[model samples]
Target: MKKIRFYHTLKAKIVIIIAMVIIFALQLMGANFITQTERQLVNNFQENQKLQMNFLENSFAPFLEMHENPKDTSEDIDPEEEINALISDFSGTGITSLIVVDSSFVVIGNSDTTQQVEVGQLLNDEDVRTTILQGSASSKQIINSQLNARRWRMVEPVYSSEDSQAVIGAIVMESNIESIYEQITDITLIFLRASLIAILLSSILANMVSKAITDPIKEMQTKAKAIAEGDYSGEVTIYGNDEIGLLAQNINELSEEVETGQRRIEAERQRLDSVLSNMSEGVIATNRRGELDVANNMASQMLNLSRDELAGQNILSLLEIEEDYSLRDLVDRKEDITLNIEAEEEDALLRASFSVIQADSGYISGIVCVLRDVTEEEKVEEERKEFVSNVSHELRTPLTSMRSYIEALIDGAWKDPELAPRFLDVAQSETDRMIRMIQDLLHLSRIDAGKSELQKELIDLTALFTQVLTRFDMLLDSEEYRFKNYKIERNIINEAIFVDVDSDKIVQVLDNVMNNAIKYSPEGGKITCTMTLENNQVLITVKDEGIGIPAEDLAHIFDRFYRVDRARSRAMGGTGLGLAISREVIEQHDGEIWAESINRDGTTFYIALPYIPYEEEEWGWD
Candidate 1:
């Protein structure tokens, strides 16, 4: 930063301003005094000239009386010679010249004898003509170029003694007063010299006063700079025990407090940095302007952002909070809020604690948010609920049926051997259903707990499919034939397909798929079975011509206890756990199974398993 110069300082500028104002006032007073004195002197000189013109007017009065009456008493004298005698009589009254004009405006008299012969010339000067008409006096001053002096010309009318309003002629007087103006100019010079001396003295005094005031301030400024550089030892050495010295004392005290506070703040900042960086929960704070000002390391990681990227971002826009709430709303909250947030790559459960950053006076300044990731906790809670519901539902039906059958046996159905045996069989079947459900639940729980493993083997898929289909074909021989008139059409390649998998589990998967197909197929409907080798994998498709599963239910077919037609599944002894277990088995074998269906048509279940390729020599007839 550039240091301010002395001339630019407040004290120096104030001194200059006060000096200029004082000088301007002094100069204005002197100029006005000179101007008024000169004007008064000129006015007195003009008054004196008017008095001299009045004397000339009186001298010419007798001749003017004679011209107005046109009497024979005035004709005895020569007209030219009488005017010459009249003008020459007042030559000593400070009059430069005297001229007389008749009412016809012809000059008739002159104070000089040489101009008397030429006095009959008409005087057409406007001022002389006005004097003749109005019977009054008028004067004008001009600089006489030939004489190089200021002079005044005065014209006075000479009224007739007989008719006072009638003017027969007028007197014109010229006077010189240039010497008075010269005297006033000399007086003005003296005033200007005095004003200049006064201004010089004022300037010196203003500088002394300004320096006395600014010296203390300048010393305090230097001390302040030292304090800014973290040197708080120096104090301002002021001259007197005045306000400036008191101000210097206060500045010294402020410097000490600031140094102490700075050290304390530094230590607190280091501690805060350590705590924020090591904290597990994400912490983000926004300024009152709603832009993010502080975000810890954990916050950056949780938001999938860099520290620089998160800073200065609008908090409301970053979170995309609930439609009804915003960052301001969050700040207004008095309790913590848990919200669901969709992260960049996955969904997350966030428990957010909000606090309004405030001042001691209870003024809200900004907002602070502490966020905790509860994603795994929420997932565990949801899975626990689903597991309990599924397990209870799966066990309830078998328990209810077994209870009904046992009650029937106790209610005298045992008296008839036929009824008794029938009820006993039903009870036995329900017990077997319960056992199978419990076993399946245990296996699924193990798989979910990550404790289950597949028994890997190299199995021939073609022979396996043949054996599974043959068992279904044997099912038609039973009395109540579920596969009656249901033809099993096979589309199998001649080459044998071998896959690496757990043979028993893979067999169970295929058995579930085939059983679903046969169970849902219409009587006399064809069940198509195809096995093809493509891209080093065996694709086995079991398609049935029956009522297909609905579109919405297809995606969730492998979820435990999820049945498309629950009542129908229960009637057909379908546990709804078969497909879920099959999916788990296939995934363990590194294979995939999926089912496709459309409305009112049929469903096709496809299973893909990696196959081992054989050399040409081993196949012999490839």
Candidate 2:
């Protein structure tokens, strides 16, 4: 890995550079200011010294001129005394280093007693002395050996009024310049020190100001780093109403918004998880890359794999499907598709359906594979189809036979009168069989379609049963039939047993069941018809002591043209439509019809009708 560089941040570097520049500028300014201040001090000192020298020269000039007359000088004044008086006068005027030189360029008088100077000896360095001898006023530069410093020397000539241009003694003055330079140095030092202190204080204050600005920025950086790494819990605290504080507040708001967004995303994720976990249909969802993203519990079980084992696996690999069975292709198709995935074992069959999950824009985003165990449902459907085909073939066989036989007799067998009558009877019976089959088909169709309508009315149960029994009275009275075991009971006798029903249909249902009972009964075996009302329903049961239906066939006995004993039923003149049609008519009145039987014990067909019609308001006598 490459090592990261540690570069100074923009704010820090900028602040540091600005402070340095300011300090540099202050130092330069201080240097210039000290130079100007020294110059001013020197100028002021020179001007003050020159003013003192001029005042001394003016004060002595008048006194020296008044005593210059030849006749007046000899009466009262000596030269030495006069010279001393002139030096005293110069000292009294505060002129330091006052000296008097004659016009011959020689020192004439001096203020210091230890140094008595000659009046007229020629001065070797004669710049100032020559100026005074030529009657000119002048200033000179001289070194004071005692103080080891420079001095300003001025010279002036004293002349008589009659000879203004004549040579005369001169006055010279010298003043010290070292004290002025010293004061200038001291003041310059003071200014330099003050400038340095100001620069130092300013640097410290600038650093503090920079820190105040950049510290919050640093905090913001820290918070931003945390957010980038998926931690949204940190906040930037702001302290004042400046730009930095406002920036911190904005950062804080942004963090809150991010946290809220994350929470909402989490909630949505949980909701999706719940939906997937609880879904009944096995859901195996794949991404656009054809990788399995999620698989619900049902999907895991359907694939016979653990949850963890299915995750992140290729969808095709997880399903153990061929490579050509691409989920990506299915999604690209954008239509629902059915795929049958056979089990690994030869005899086992497992089918999986792949559907494309589409977005609102109608693009397929992923694939959802729904798995189901459809073995039983597929088997039942196959059986139902086979049963229907068999029924059709069976019914067609009998109809074809009857039609062929009837046509054969009509074409030729009628030529013989005896054969014709017998053939006609057979044809009639076959026709009746055909009629019964058609009627049974119609009845079953009506019931299945829920279109069977019954003519409902209040019915007296006792009279209906009496009429049914009376219709079979001759069979009951015959000794050969042996009605010894016959019994009829009406438990709701005097109560009228009034029920809302289609009486004619109910009687027909009862008669059909009773006839079946009588036909199936053994000679002298019991035949029972019982009527009772219980729980607001009227129940009629007809039972026979005969060979009963097999347990397995009892459930399907009422199916159209279904016979438990086909040959025996035909021999007994049964069209196999009686029970089916009866069941339809009974059920049309909002009733139930069923049969109970055991092998060789007996068969009982029970019919139950509700006392109140399903449509009570439309029912008569309601």
Candidate 3:
């Protein structure tokens, strides 16, 4: 027995399946052909035997007539001799044996009786005896010991003419059937040989067909193995227009894409490596596994460890912190975390900022560590804070002294009626100055603390602008300030320009802006207030053709207590917090406020307020 390998290749399996199906089909056809041919041969043999039997029955009539008439009595005519002559004639006609049996089942004449036992000694079988007794013909095939062969035997009863009712004897004929079996066996052998040939051809054809299919797959496997070993230069050749050809095309395209992607990735990796090494700040990277996969030169130096020592080590352990503070924790938490890691060999204070590196799917893939030495930055910040505090304190000292002196004069100098009004006016002016300073401080504080709030609601912006312009209506009417150049369009409006806003705060902002415009403008200078709707928000602009703000002062106009000219601002009673407060109010409404100025062209302050109030809850903040 051949040892069958359990692991059959795809080609082998397919070939085996096809061959088995072909062999089975051929076997079925061969069996049907053999069976049909055998049946047909048997039928033909039976038909020939019937014909022979009919001839024998017809010839027996003449012999029976001769026996009845007792012919040739004077010419030495022997009846037994005549019967033997008839048997010999019948034997020449392809019958294997011919015998005449009497009414008592005794054989009288036979062609080959001498070589075997004579008629008197031979026992008559049931078929022959029954035929004579019934006076009818019957046929069967039996094995005869006298001839030592199988033979088809037929027996017919013969009657006498003198007594028609008397049955005389039976004429029996036997034909050998061995030749029919020989012909059938020869046909079967031919079918068996044809079937074997068909099976062999089918097996060879199946092998060829299987090879056609499996060869492409084998080539694909070879290419895939080569790709695994980093050889992306090969191309797959496609054959014929079928699924296999399409698969080959796809494989070729995939190889090209993979090669391109690999090159790009290599370039990116090299660029990142150079950036990390050259950066002044220390950079560290870790994979999702929480191990330090990459560290820059600065990072290695800051940690007082070689790159080899840091690589593949758990970042938390390498840093030697007690708590489980690591890059992994920062990435998993998705929140900014600060860790103070100290160098083992050096006295360096390293502040590390751990940020999550997220993929496009919003999954935290890794963490990026940006380590900076903040020792100098911290010192600078502290010094700036102290300097601001000192400046504020120094400015407050003079204001406080002025307030005290003005109060004393108002209380005592009123007794001198001649000097009372001047003292009272100076006291009020000093008080106003102090009030402006305090208000500026409060506005700055509100912006710094992020506590500014806007109570927004829909209001007729046309009406609001009209009211703002009315406050300066008296100044516009005076000849001391010519208003011909001024263009204040109250009629031109969005019928109901509405904005969600704090009405009181907006009014204060408008008042301060309009007052500054009026005070700075020359007698004939123009002041225009224009309103427009843009991007679902209302843009209200105040334009003034006056001594415009200096370009250098434009950026700092919104700063607390900041002024282009301190003496001029004091003379005009200008509180520098107006624009600062305006900015905060606009921002609270999810809007924006800014100023555009040139040295001499003029200045325009723009305030944009959203039509709808933004809900803070939607921002994912508590």
Q: Which has the greatest lDDT?
A: 1
TM-score of each model, paired residue for residue: 0.46, 0.38, 0.38
Question: Candidate 3 lDDT, tens digit per residue, 5-111?
Answer: 63478878887887788778878887888788877877787788788766765666555555546652435655567777777787876688788776767666777
CA lDDT of each candidate?
0.81, 0.70, 0.73
Candidate 1 least-lDDT 10 residues? 110-119
Model 3 CA deviation exceeding 4 Å by range: 1-420, 475-491, 612-622
Model 2 C-alpha RMSD vs. true structure (Å) is: 46.9
Q: Which candidate leads the pack in TM-score?
A: 1
The residue pairs in collision within model 1 are none
**Any runs in candidate 1 off by more than 4 Å, and if so which?**
1-278, 284-295, 299-370, 373-380, 612-622
Q: Write the per-residue lDDT of candidate 1 for residues 92-118, one digit (tens) a residue.
A: 666667788888887777664554335
Question: How does candidate 3 fare on TM-score?
Answer: 0.38
With candidate 1 superimposed using the best TM-score fit, by how many Å does residue 553's alpha carbon deviate from the native? 0.8
lDDT, residue 443, candidate 2: 69
